[model samples]
Target chain A: MSRVIQIAGLRYRYPDGTQALDGIDFHLNSGESVALFGANGSGKTTFVLHLNGLLRGEGSIEICGMRLADGTLEQIRSKVGVVFQDSDEQLFMPTVLEDVAFGPLNLGLSPDDALTRARTVLKRVGMAHAFERAPYHLSAGEKKRVAIAGVLAMDPEILVLDEPTTFLDPPTRRDLLSLLRSLPQAKVVVTHDANLARALTSRAVFFDQGRITGQGDVIEIIQRFHWEYS
Target chain B: MHHLVIDRWSRGSSSLHQRDPRAKLAALLVFLVVLSTTRPGAQWAFVAYAVLLILTANLARLPILGLASRAALVLPFSATFALLTWWSGDSLRALALAEKSFLSGTAALLLVGTTPLTGWTAALESWRVPRMLILVIQFVYRYLFVIAEQVQRMRWAALCRGPKQRGFRLAAGLVGVLFARSWQRADGIYHAMLARGFRGRFVPAPPAPFRSSDALFLSTCLAGCLAIRMLL
Candidate 1:
């Protein structure tokens, strides 16, 4: 498989001197799905943020063979779609259609085309009925679907989902997992759900205090980290 | 919750709601200017303005009572100044002061109540309003509910801990924590925007074409307001 993302010696420090990410190396092949397992504040989120140039750390990073630099930032962003854990943060437009259209509109698509793409993706995510609904008015599951639709509307090559199932209930989580599995793009999922990781990803990477502690088969990594409770 | 009601009202399919936003905005400006300049003693003009607003609200299919009550939100502020004027021995002027403020508020509400936020905001953009100011308005409107919900949850959590939590001290602490949480949310929102390839300015949706009916609507409003100013 061809490499879709490559990073070397990645390190990031917040303004308050917190070493959020420290010398991390990671890679994801095209069409591959990987799960990131870590305790809260273990730098999984920070690492994925660098994949799309949202959080630039001191490192050499590449997305779809394009260097993550100033000139290539926009292009790289269009290649790596990040669905934030909080759907509220991502779905900021007044209506569902507009929120989903936001990314396509940003990519210089004409309004009509963007709206068309948004509608198509919303339909794909089973949120076609919510086209005119306010994002805040939707239930958590619906909001999550719309959030995914928003990212999907961008037609990115790689999907970086940060806690995609954060607030979803059992049936909603099952629906989400199925919807996610249907997408064709490679994925980097930052999650804590062991079953989710096992079901959705072939490989897993564990982070500890801003560094990778283990990387292997999904079940192996989960077992090594004692990531699940009986 | 009032805004939510208005939001729902704005999405209705009445003739008044179908009027172009630019026409509605211009009509609002003309109404406000005419009402503001009407002499304080012209009680008939004030009555006419109220009738006009009521007629328009009915035409828009909005709940007249809801619109009136929401518009009365401005009265408390105007009543303070009206009280001063009344104490200064000009009760008519005091009444007109309150009248002008209420009429103006209702007229403005009529515009927004009929036109969705995007419609009017896009109208403002077409008029060459400062992009920065429009951006601020859009962002605040979009996130106001999210922040309000957060505050509600925080308040509930505090109340759950103890009944004595309903005081200025608790409010102050909530405000502080809210400020910090809002800050973090803002950061997350900005990052999300970046992830979607937002380059400084928002990509505006294409503006709707202004039709001849919209022109006629604006003309009717202009004539009505001016005639009221001269005759009443």
Candidate 2:
């Protein structure tokens, strides 16, 4: 399998002088899914943000064979879709359809074509009935679904989801896991849910204080870290 | 929740709602200008303006009382200036000041009540309003609910700890924490935007075609405002 993401010697420090991501190396093969397991402040989110050039850290990062640079920023972003932890933050457009169309519109799709793509993806995610609805009006599950649809509309090669099941009930979480499992893109999921990691990912990486502490098969990583609450 | 109500109202199927946003915006401009220039002692003109707004609200199938009550939110701000005028021995001007402000608020609310945010903001974009200003407005409107919810949660947490913790100190602490949370949320939102390939400017959707009915609507509004100003 071809590598979709490759990172070497990656490090980031916040403006306030906090070391968020220490020197790290990681890679994801095409169609492979990896779960990032870490504590709240363990740099999981900071590391994933670098995949799409959202954060400018000191690193040699490549996406789908394209080196991270100013000119390749847009192309790289289009390749790596990041679904944020907070659905409210991600779904910023006035209506569900408009929000879903946002990425395509940015990627230079014509409004008509963009709206059509948005509709198809919304239907794919089973949110077809919420096209005209405001984002604030949606239930948590529906909002999560629409957020996923927004990213899917772009048709990225890699999906980076941070805590995708944050506010979901068990049934909603199960539905999301099934939907996520069906997607073909390579994924880097930053989550605390061991069950989700076990169910969706083949590999797992553990982070501690801005460094990778462990990496291996998903179940083994979970077992090694004592990740789940008893 | 109040904004949510306005949001739902904006999606109505009335003729006013169906009218092009540009047309309604033009009508709102005309009404504001005419009402602002009306003479202070012409109380009848103010009454006429109020009646005209009520009639438009009726035509739009909106609850007039709801519109009036929400519009009255502007009264306290205008009341201070109105009081100054009253203290300056121009009671007529003070009353007219309040009347003009109230009527203007109602008229503005009418346009937004009938036109969805995307519709009206798109109209503003077409009119060459600064893209940055529009972005700020859109962001503020979108995140207001999130911020409000945060405030409620924080307040609830505080109340859970101690019911007596209700005063300036608690309120001040809440504001400080809320500001920090909002800052973090803003950063997340900007990152989300960039991850979705947002460049410096937002990509606007293509504007809808303005039909002949839209032009007719603008003309009718212009004529009504002019007639009221000249005759009443």
Candidate 3:
């Protein structure tokens, strides 16, 4: 299987001298899903941010065989769709349809084509009825669906979902989990939900103090890191 | 909440709402100019301006009383200047000052109440407004609801401690915290945008074609306002 992402010797430090990421090596095969397990401030997010060039650090990273560089940044971004932890941040357009169309429009699709693609993905996410509704007016689950639709409209090859199930009720989380599992793209899920990790990902990587400490089966990593509350 | 009401009103199907945003924008400019230049003591002109706004609101199928109450929000600010003029013995100008401000607010509200944010913002873009300024306006309009909700949640959390805990200190502290949160939220939003191939500029949707009917609408509005200013 071809690898969609490859990273080596990745290191990052904030402007305030805080070391956020240290010597990380990671890879994801096409059609594979991995769970990223880490405590707050352990560099899980900073590491993923590097995959799309949102945060640049001294690292060797390749997305879809293209090196992460200024010239390839835009193309790399189109390949790696990051669903942020907060749906509020991801869905900023005035209406749900427009928000979903945002990524496609940014990809240079004509407005008519963008809207059509938006409708298709919104339907895929089961949010077809809310095309005209404002993002703020949606419930937590609905917002997440629209956020996913927005990213999906870009037709990205790999998905990076950060805390996708946050702030959702049990039923909503269940629905979102199913919706996510049904997508065909390779995914790297940054989450605290052990059940979600087990259900959606076959492999897992554990991070501690800005480095990957362990990687193996999902259950093994969870047990090694003591990542669950109960 | 004010924006919520206007947003709902803007979605309603009416002839006035169906008129193009550029047309409404053009009419608003004409009304403002005519109203502002009227003689201070020409009470009849003020009355005629109010009537014109009322007629427009009626045609738009909006609630006149609700619009008037919301537009009255500008009164306290304008009343300050009006009171100074009244104290200086220029009662005519004071009355006119209050009248103009109220009419202006109502007229502005009429345009917004009939046109969606996308429509008006697109109109501004088509008029060659600075891209940065239009972007700022769009972001502010989009996030105001989120900020308002956060403020309410913070207020509730504060009130849970004790009803009597409210004071200037508490208010100031709330504002500070809100400011910090907003900054963080803005950063997250920017990152999200970047993650989706945002290249530092927003690509607007295809422009809605302005029809000849819209031009007729604009001409009629300008002519009516001019006639009111000249003859009344």
Candidate 4:
């Protein structure tokens, strides 16, 4: 019913004069799951970084039509949960419980509340038994689950996942995809996997060389990209 | 996997390994202080101290040699002989000093090797150590092994293909990389800790408390130490 995230004329270039994003306009509706499909260096990571105010570009980003600003950055981040591509980088804490507790703790939840939320999310991700295990001691699939739980504990309404299935074995990937599909939030996913994009979202946008190539059904883009390239 | 560092030191079945870390730490420190305060080799006194340390180690099932080697690793190049030559006093004093230091080191190793790092940290909390100090110690102890492992892995990886000298540079660069990685890692950990609402005090896991046997064993050891220091 409402545009939860809106962007227009977003242009960003690295200081070394390499352009990463150019004239990007995108919007995410409330409770919509959208997939951003692109090949390598298609500026997907840069775009998601802007969502959480981790980067700045020439374009505007409006969450529920509010402009990104100093006060709003934290609010935007709190509302928009982002799981980075590398679970290794994301799950850097000593123990699973501690990592899961981090975001809520930052939000100033009491220790018991933080522990409660942490335990709940860990159980949701099927990692309840891994509460005391260190990050380096986990399997890749388990680490990814822990990372997602870390974000889930924050209770964000919008989830942005960057390449969630990378490095996972087939079974682990399937589990992760199923988990993603089950989340009730509005999701904007950036991935190179076409079938995953088709399986997870009703809407799809193709990005290439710093600009949008087309926007339509994921199956259509998949067929179109293959046809044009072949 | 119960990969406790304490187990690395011993396989002993003694109740000392299961004792409260706070009591052990306090006792060990007191023993070390008394030994240090004593003038060099009082043979009878030194023998008694050595027997105490060895007895503790034996009971804890810790490898005395492994602990001793580790303790001696921090020694300067000039050791027993150098002390013998350098000391203005008699050779007995030199021997005594070395023996005393060795006993102190053994006591420390026995304490640490028997107690889990987390348990020892909780013991610090029990002793009213400042929260910030405990946090700092915890972080340093937790990451030290991580950083070491990373550095070793990096070196090994580089050594497989590169020249030895080149590998050294790469490994040194890895050390620098580790510094950056650890800083980033520390930031992530700090945030993760903050998110989890970790304010300060370490959460102590209450293992089974002291049994009658543990008290009797500690009391016997305590009595022996007092007797050795006072009587002999």
Best by DockQ: 1
Superposed by TM-score, candidate 2 places the C-alpha of residue B97 at a distance from the truth, in angstroms, of: 3.8
Q: How close is candidate 2 to the true structure, as a TM-score?
A: 0.90
Per-residue alpha-carbon lDDT of candidate 1 for residues A1-230, written as tens digits (9 for 90 to 100): 89999999999999999999989999999999999999999999888888888788998998899988999999999899998999988888878999999999999999999999999999999998988887878999999899889988889999998888888899999999999999999999999999989889999999999999899999999988899956
Structure candidate 3, residue pairs in collision: none
Query: Looking at model 3 chain B, which ten-residue stretch has the lowest summed lDDT?
Result: B197-206
Count of steric clashes across candidates, in order: 0, 0, 0, 11
lDDT of 2 by residue, A1-230 (tens): 89999999999999999999999999999999999999999999889889999888998999999999999999999999999989999999889999999999999999999999999999999999999888989999999999999999889999999989987999988998899999999999999989889898999999999999999999999999999977
**DockQ, cand. 4:** 0.18
Note the residue pairs that clash in candidate 1: none
lDDT of 4 by residue, A65-172 (tens): 669887776666677788877676677545678778777776777777888999999999999898877676688899889989998888887888888888899998
- Considering only chain B, report the TM-score of each candidate against the true chain B: 0.94, 0.91, 0.91, 0.78
Q: Which stretches of candidate 3 lie over 4 Å from their true place?
A: B40-44, B79-94, B155-176
lDDT of 1 at A21: 90
| Every model: iRMSD | 1.1, 0.9, 1.0, 5.2
lDDT of 3 by residue, A1-230 (tens): 99999999999999999999989999999999999999888999989899899999998999999999999999999999999989998888888998898888889898899999999999999998998887887999999999999999889999999989989999999999999999999999999899889999999999999999999999999998898989
**Stretches of model 1 off by over 4 angstroms after superposition:** B165-171
Give DockQ per model, in order.
0.76, 0.74, 0.72, 0.18
Q: Cα lDDT of model 1 overall? A: 0.91
